[model samples]
Target: MTTLNACFRGQLGDFQLDFEFSIPSRGVTALFGPSGCGKTTLLRCIAGLNFLPEGKLEVDGEIWQNGKQFMPTHKRPIGYVFQEPGLFAHLNVKRNLTYGRRRAGIKSSNDNELHELTGLLGIDHLLERDIHALSGGEKQRVAIARALLMKPRLLLMDEPLSALDQDNKNEILPYLEQLHSHLEIPVIYVTHDRREVERLADHLLLLKEGSIIAKGEIGELLTRPDLPFGRAQDAVTVLDGQVRHYDARYGLSTLQIEGGTLEVPDQLGPTGVYKRLRIASTDVSLSHQEALNTTILNRLPAVIWKILPTDGPSLNILLRIGNMGEGSPLLASVTRKSVEQMALKEGQQVYAQIKGASLLGSSSTTQPRAHCMTPLIACE
Candidate 1:
């Protein structure tokens, strides 16, 4: 499988950044960390904005930087979107979008491509409007469109929604989600927001103080009890499933996942359509036996994988959702008292009762290859 290989080591003032990893060359790869963890700095290094002396970046077998050779930022086929829209105040949306294409030496004959992109972003109607006349969300859509028009091999987004208010963030998320289904280029998204990672990312790179704490597929990393994400207060498990059946009378759709089936309260799509589901750890409960008379509709046999204490009086239980204990992962946050009373232990069989599960969005039927990260040694 094709991959993007990156390794960097450098110091800025008193802080140091050192890491190495490889992810699939398609789908969204999220760089997630808190402020000052060097998320943006790492992104800049990848974009050639920060030239590290000991850095090597290879995107899908093409070497951008290695040893003495380096690719200049302007020469690299990259599309960058910053926190701010960064649109030209003087130009209308149409002109602003076409500017990148024109600079890239693409002919105006590609207008059909432009129209298709604008339509996907829901920005075709705003093409005639001035930059100042657009809302925060609209302006960002235009910025995204402009970047895509460059026909980049890789796209870098450094908190593109950070400048927008909550309303604007909500407004643009759907369009951003649409890109997952349409775009073929690899996207490196930098954000501190876990919500964004859950909604958009296929792979995750967790960073802390310029170092990678963990890197893997989003689903696997999110449910690992050893990771902070699994014990987080807002921890959630993301599952990829295909719609198998829909009952219009109850407006419920049955989804088949790796381990078991889930019934969501919506008609997601026709049979065989893929969708992503988010189940909160708090919404899951475990019982030794399946309750046949319960109000809960989704229940699956699972094996207790791990039990760890959280920041509060709760314990986070990691479960493998199948009778044989070899299936997709699930997380349940239960009170410590409940665990002590039930005598739950690793490898024990139990039924996971899910109270609610939300549909993140439709996913591509063809899943991307899992990300592969090289182990890093400490750099002195």
Candidate 2:
């Protein structure tokens, strides 16, 4: 299996960063943590900008750095996108994009590739516009396209959206999602935003105080009761499901998940199309038996996996969604009084009534798709 292996031990000022891990060479791997946690520092290390003598880095079997040899930043096949767009103010958008290809000594065939990339990023129409006239989101899209024009084996993004306002962030997110679904290059994204992690990342590396607290698949890490994410007050579970059926009459699509089916309110796509789902703990409720008269439409049998106290008055309940507790996990937050009133306990079987869910993004789209915030209101 292709993987990127990295190990670094270094000291910068009074702070020390020591960590080692390997992730797949495709999909987005988020370097997630709070401020001053060494996310950007680690990214720079991987890019050869902050070389450490004790560090070793490999990308898909190529040794970029080792004790015996060190590859320079420009020599390594990498695309770096910083917080700022860094576009040339005097250049047109098309000229700015072609500059990278020219620097890399790419041939005239880059014209066709550039056209395709610009179209994918929704910047083909803006190719003739000057960089100075573009919006924040538009400039960032051009920056991303310019990076891709160089055809890098790995991409490093250091909080590319941190400088944008909410409107621009929202405008650029779908384009980022398109890149995540369509590109084959591995991306190391540094960010402190949980929402961005939920929507874009396939793998996660959680850092705290310059040390790795957790590293694994994003879905598993987000729902593990022992992790900080699962214990947080606004914790949520992410699930990937395929559209099995769509009812045009009621405007609902049935999504087949790991161990069950969910009736999402939107027509996600044709059958067999895949999409991501986000279910918050607060949006889920529990009952000993399925309520027949309630307005809730999503009620699935689940077995209690674990129960833990939260930082607030409520407790976090982890449930395995299946008859024998052999399926996808779900989280439900309920008060201590309700837990006592319902006699909830580990290993007990109950029903998970999902109050709502958000459709994050599509896995099959070549271009950006508008995210659906439609609440999941029914299931069968």
Candidate 1: count of backbone clashes, pairs at least 3 residues apart or interchain: 0
1-380: candidate 1 lDDT, tens digit per residue: 54677888877567798778776657889999999999998888888988877788887678898845899999889999999988999999999998877777877665798899999999999889999899999999999999999989999999999999999999999899888778888898999889999989888999999898898889999998889999987789998888899999999999888789999997888788778889999999999999999999999999999997788879899999989888889999999999999999999999999999998865445443245545332223
1-380 per-residue lDDT for model 2 (tens digits): 44678888778667798878776757888999999999999999888998777778887678888854799998988899999999999899999999888878977743778888898899999999988889999999999998988888999999999999999999999989877877877889999999999999888899999988888878878889889888988999988777889999999999877678899897898887778899999999999998989988888889999997889999999999998888888899999999999999999999999999898864564222222111111111
Clashing pairs in 1: none
Score residue 179 of candidate 1 by CA lDDT: 85
Per-model CA lDDT versus the true structure? 0.87, 0.85
Could you tell me every candidate's TM-score relative to the true structure?
0.95, 0.94
Q: Write out the backbone clash pairs for model 2.
A: none
Q: After superposition on all CA atoms, what RMSD does each candidate show versus the true structure? A: 2.1, 6.7
For candidate 2, the per-residue lDDT at 202 reads: 82
Lowest summed lDDT over 10 consecutive residues: which window, candidate 2?
371-380
